[model samples]
Target: MINNHMLKRKLDWDYRQRCIYMTTVTVEKRRPLLGQLTGGLGNPTVELSDVGIMVAQCWQEIPTHVPGVSLLEWQVMPDHFHGIIFVQAPQEKPLGAIVGAFKAHSTSLYRAGARQEAHLWSPGYQDTILLHRGQLANMRAYIQDNPRRLAVKRAHPELFRIIRNISACGHIFAAIGNHFLLDAPVKRQVQISRSVPPDALAAAEADLLAAALHGAVLVSPCISPGEKQIARAALQAALPLIVILENGFPPLYKPPKSYFDACAAGRLLMLAPWPHHTDRRSLTREQCLALNRFATQIAQEDHTP
Candidate 1:
């Protein structure tokens, strides 16, 4: 039988595989000793400190130290690093061992150099197994834009701050981005089915865009393709939007670039009724119904005092 602890944390996959992985290794106690985020809004970059430089150098040497593992890309931030590692050939060492060795070596260097901290990194790095097409491109773009995104979030902290105990409609949710968008007088749920044809979807999206232009907040789970289209249109139009997510917000969660831009513009709100989790899960039928119902309830109820 699988233990609860294993269920919560383990991926249940053979670690020795030729797989591509995206990993995030954070600094101990979330310190910003890695580097300073510098430059203007249009052109932001990380000015790596001595510690940050050492971390980058160690990361670059991973391929040399770990057999059959090669580096794809990496970005060093104020408190953490995001990197993509390609295991082109199966190695005796698992991903965890590889990351562990990297951390151990980095700590040894820190100590040898007489750094104040006993260790450089926190325990247990987070890894995402890249299994789908286009995911690599997306992750690469995400890694590339970390500096700029961090700059935007820092500049507009109010828009991206997580606000809890947000009572909307009949339910309560934790939220991020433009909470005042909740108070908008008019809101409509974008409920487009998967069966919707392309032409029909375009027409429906157009109608929703018209409503959004007339000061309406478009709420959606963004489940189906049509729903995604509608949400994308609303975002492109720079109108108010409310998205009901299946999973709750992670503590250090930052919205992706597209959503980040909308949040920075004070036009987006992501609502989550569930607690945060790390496990990858499929959307069950029950979850779909609940989210759709939640979206409808949010749209119908008035949030204004």
Candidate 2:
């Protein structure tokens, strides 16, 4: 089994910029790599030359329905596949939607022929949006060198270049066309407000505030002068404040600090359910829920005594 390290960088979803992204997906174990990779030295058991070709075509077709898109370097590894998918923001769908389409269509084909209900691939995939020039080059190099790293010395890299062109940055390269993909709609900046009774609002606010303080990046809900004061205090203490307001109402006031990162140590909290700590830190969802339940049980017992 391969030992993987804990992923470090957290991607801030930018809804306004279209960016090039690299996605790594893996196949189910006990399945031969032959079907995934083909035309390489040291033949794989389940030669997927046909499947890889089909997927490559699918990657190209993605841009037709989705605007501002292109395919860069891609390879089908024995147990995994790495591909650079480009997306121009403000297009037809989210990046996840694109991945889902690939996964769904490919799985259907694999299932119908394989006649096995076993998982076709792993559930989680890794995606990184190229935020800067250095990162973009790194992603392209990674995809291009995958053949050599996988010990396929006989493979030719140029065969995989379905698209390539010169970049205006004075460097010619293969990247999903230049366009900033908008951040897809996600649950961020939650609001709790005056629509509810002030008392309930306070309680809900406290719950959300507590959740954020305990590691949620929730902004404050109210924009009142008092709320802004509270936000200022929380930032001073290095707590991330979730800016909130009653539904459809502008913030009555803005907080003193304009920069959120300056308030915290660049620590962004993960979004999770109640009793669910964000997975941003090391703890898993199960571990978080279990520990909380256990603590609650002990507290209940002490109260009875």
Candidate 3:
């Protein structure tokens, strides 16, 4: 006999264990105080490597302080920080207490510096638990690229364009430098030396599709961390055997309805391996075509122009 309020609280509190989480903690003024420490533009100037090390150290400190909690990679941006904490609900202290302790420790250390200014962080924080595997990768990218997101917002000004458009085009798209993936083995293979214009993109895509079509199984890792560039690239190329590794839940093979929607709507088609089907190499080109046709039919039936 759980009351409504207790049931709701239980539902919320149940997000522990391998439940990947994303937390964005901003500064008091969004002052880019984190940048002062990691952006290479601040007074005491903190290098990105140094920030990474500091975050790692903080992560290590958690198990000792709160027990049953493990730290994951995080990014310190100009104005905020994004981190993931793995909480083992069985043995860990309350999540709120753990977060507060971590924040207090970091804020104390940050403010103790000789150049200490206003409060190190804004009030409270934001958190989302990863119930699905794809969300894990999405959260990783969200944390690492907070600064890039800010830049895009400031430079573009029109947030609407960013929200509506999903394709990659122009020089800015080509000039991106990615090292988000830990231990990049195939990065050199994917780097494009020249700027490709929109008009010629389709021709290039056809060529890419032809090249990748022969493979029985194609594994396409999302851009290091969770950057969507590689996924977007694969979508643009219309590669048939493509698979996207989303969060840690194993690769979801069947592309989400939203992903297929983009393809049917004349945008790029970013297909991945369907989930629960382990033997990907078993999928033949004919099966791929059949799946694609089915996806098209579904999209046409449900999606509006």
Worst 10 residues of 1 by lDDT: 1-10
Question: In angstroms, how far off is 241's CA in candidate 3?
Answer: 27
Relative to the true structure, how large is the alpha-carbon lDDT of every model?
Answer: 0.86, 0.46, 0.43
The lowest-lDDT stretch of 10 consecutive residues in candidate 2 is 177-186
Which scores better on lDDT, 1 or 3? 1
Which candidate number would show the highest lDDT if scored against the true structure? 1
Ranking by TM-score: 1, 3, 2
Which stretches in model 1 have alpha-carbon errors above 4 Å? Answer: 1-10, 115-117, 303-305
RMSD of 2: 20.2
TM-score of 1: 0.91
True lDDT of residue 190, candidate 3: 24
User: Over the full model, what C-alpha lDDT does candidate 3 score relative to the true structure?
Assistant: 0.43
Candidate 3 per-residue C-alpha lDDT over 90-179 given as tens digits, one digit per residue, 9 for 90 to 100: 544445566667777777766666356536666666666667867777767655554544443344333212121222211011101111
Collision count for each candidate, in order: 0, 26, 8
Better of 1 and 2 by TM-score: 1
